[model samples]
Target: MSLPNDASEDRMQMMTKTERFSKLFDELERCREDEQMQKMEEMNGLIDEMNEEELKSIFTIELFDKIHQIIEEKTLPLENALVLLKHVGYYRELKIIYLESFDYSLLRERMKEMIIDENEKKEEINEKILTDLCECYALLGEDDIFGEVLSIIVPCLLKVALKKDETEEAQKEVEMALLALGNIGYWVEKESYGNEIKEIIKYHQEHQNLTRLAYQSAWEFLIKRFHNYESLEEVFVNDLHFAREARREIEELKRDVDWKRKEETGKEAKELLIFRKWIYNIDNYFTSCKLWNEEVEKLLSSFVQMIREFRDNSKKVSNWCFFSITNAAENRNVKIDDLLKSGAVDAFSEEMKQSTLEDKIVYDCLYFFLNVSRRLNEKKDDEKKEAKRKSIKRKMFEWIEEGYEDVMTSFHAILPDLAEKSKFLQLSKYSSDYLWSL
Candidate 1:
């Protein structure tokens, strides 16, 4: 070659290289234009045959090749490339195609495109895009996608929720975004992003326009994601709204908890140990929130279905019930009477009395007396129903005052200096004014 490289030989070698590289690239560009034209023709032809699904399927594969080639050639803008990926069901197909070709450059570029699009729209109206993106992220259920979308979505929703000029629509959108983040962060175990999502949720709930939505969303999130937190009982006892909302969520979560645990914990335990922990937590949580009447009723139904092989955890259950209600009332200004009248207190006393007499049980006893005192104070004197109401009220106060004295006697026996403790001092005086308003 060095000895006698003629002009023809040199020209041939150069042409061969150029032809090998440039020919495919030119064909790719032409194929893309053809694909676009064919799509339009297909739409027009649908006026007769009208096979929309078939038309979409046909175009999807055709465009995939064209876009793949274009990507390899690096002959188009990244945004334009992403446009082809966004067609109905195209992204999933592209996922398989890219995996086969072993060309991840396109995927990497797509990720970049997502980031760019998110940033650009974040400053403008992002409700639709963010909602769609969250849907995609949730459907994908891949940690990478979930984490990526959640990181941006939480902050942006927080920003929008905090804006003074934000609309109700914007607030609703923020709720959806927060819900999405909670799903990914909790269900997917993205602990790295969980705290951030929690913070954003707290912020959204703090905003005036979105408080109701935020409460609703936070309620859903905890049930869906952190229903099994070790401190769930504490949270339910301390937070009234959280406790009430948790009751609804726990009902829904119970159905899927076994399957979810099977997926999350294989071979560790055939059945879910987490379910028992959940029950333990929920048992206490429901008591704290005054959802025990409903939850216990559900538990009784479940127990009926699986008889004779019971776990004999009534002691734990009783203790939880007693402490949760008592502490909830003691710390907060919550009246046990209101809880009872709301129908949440039905059958709870009976359940507590039958259960073990732990510290938690003692708390329930205290609440029972509180409820009786409250009913006594609110005894109505209607002329038509006076005798019946008064009879009920008199018995309730007698029972309640006697019970209160008994508990105090027990407290004095257990802790002789109990009267000097600040805990008893914290009991709020009966609010006749508030009761009258009701």
Candidate 2:
């Protein structure tokens, strides 16, 4: 009654795909420790080869429940388990199961244990674990759980962020912690943790010890959580107002015709130095948000004045002014006419003539010109559609014509050297290509 070889082969081919997958799963479960990794790899390969319908049919709720059980028992490393979930395209389902099955408490307890153990060892925290834990809590969005997690995670993050004489690895840890804090900031109850988080970030923002990258992360966190104009306005403008008052006093003193008084005023003007740093940090936020209404108009006007007046005294402030204006113009939210009338064109043109200016400053100036020129070209393209458009284009064209020669002369003088520098090569290439096209 034994089957022939051909008949046996036919019977093996007749086995359904799901039956084969089930055999693989059983083999994986029974595999020895040394073979488990190989089995998982094969499973992943088979899963990839299966079509969506086949996958759906094979990966049933029962199988998922088994996977969850394995995860809870720590049969596999957490990262490896998460990766498997990702490859299987079941991360969302897994998230839902975890949220609904009261598994967050388990995750929370694990995180707390890990933090305590690391602290006891006086070791750098495991950033990857904390990041994953935070991401899970963020997705769950349960306020109480989020608050508890935040309370634990924030202290650990601050410890890293505030570490003295940190190693390179510790610096990286600080970055990861800040990024995680930012991601977690999106889910926490603003009333309870918002001000607390802001205070921590503000400390970093004003702290002299932290790197620029740290300050940037702090600002990004604020922008992510509180995106409104008023919130940002309070952070940037309140301090800026004091700086502006001091600037005005310095300006008035410049016209005093008293050499002694002017020198005294120059010393006081140096106080505005800190404001320049704050302005540099917040300018991109202002430009990206397009907070160009009447209130910010004063700020923009002040920038134009700063470029004209402080160009010789503080190139840093001047460079930032050009950057803010360039960003605003690039977004096309600020009117080109307003920028032209504000003497931004003249200021930048003058800066371009300075042989000793930083390549970055010159790059910003050229970028501003490139943006304006591109905008002008767009307006010109629209001139054919309407008479009113033609009139506006004509005015803009005339305004640019007045400055066109000087701008191009500056561009030509700098293009050769700029095209050679490694740091500015890409931008210079872009500028060269755009100028040639025109």
Weakest 10 consecutive residues, lDDT, candidate 2?
A: 90-99
RMSD of 1: 20.6
Task: Give the lDDT of residue 213 in candidate 1.
Answer: 33
lDDT value, candidate 2, whole model: 0.53
Candidates in order, TM-scores: namely 0.31, 0.42
C-alpha lDDT of all candidate models, in order? 0.40, 0.53
Give candidate 1's error at residue 230 in angstroms.
30
Which candidate has the highest TM-score of all?
2
Tens-digit per-residue lDDT, 1-438, candidate 2:
566998865764686656666765666556665576666666665655554456667656556566656667766556654444444532222211222322333543554455445444545666556544444333333233444446666666655555545567766556544544544444444344445445655554355444434444455455544443335445544533323432343344334323343246433221242344345434655455543454455556667787876577655556777787777667676766666666666576666666577877777777777777676555343546445445545665554435455555656666667756735334534444333222
Clashes of each: 2, 0
User: What lDDT does candidate 2 reach at residue 330?
Assistant: 73
**lDDT: worst 10-residue window of model 1:** 93-102
Q: Show model 2 residue runs off by greater than 4 Å.
A: 1-221, 224-273, 353-357, 379-393, 397-403, 413-416, 419-425, 428-438
Q: What is the C-alpha RMSD of each candidate to the true structure, in Å?
A: 20.6, 19.0
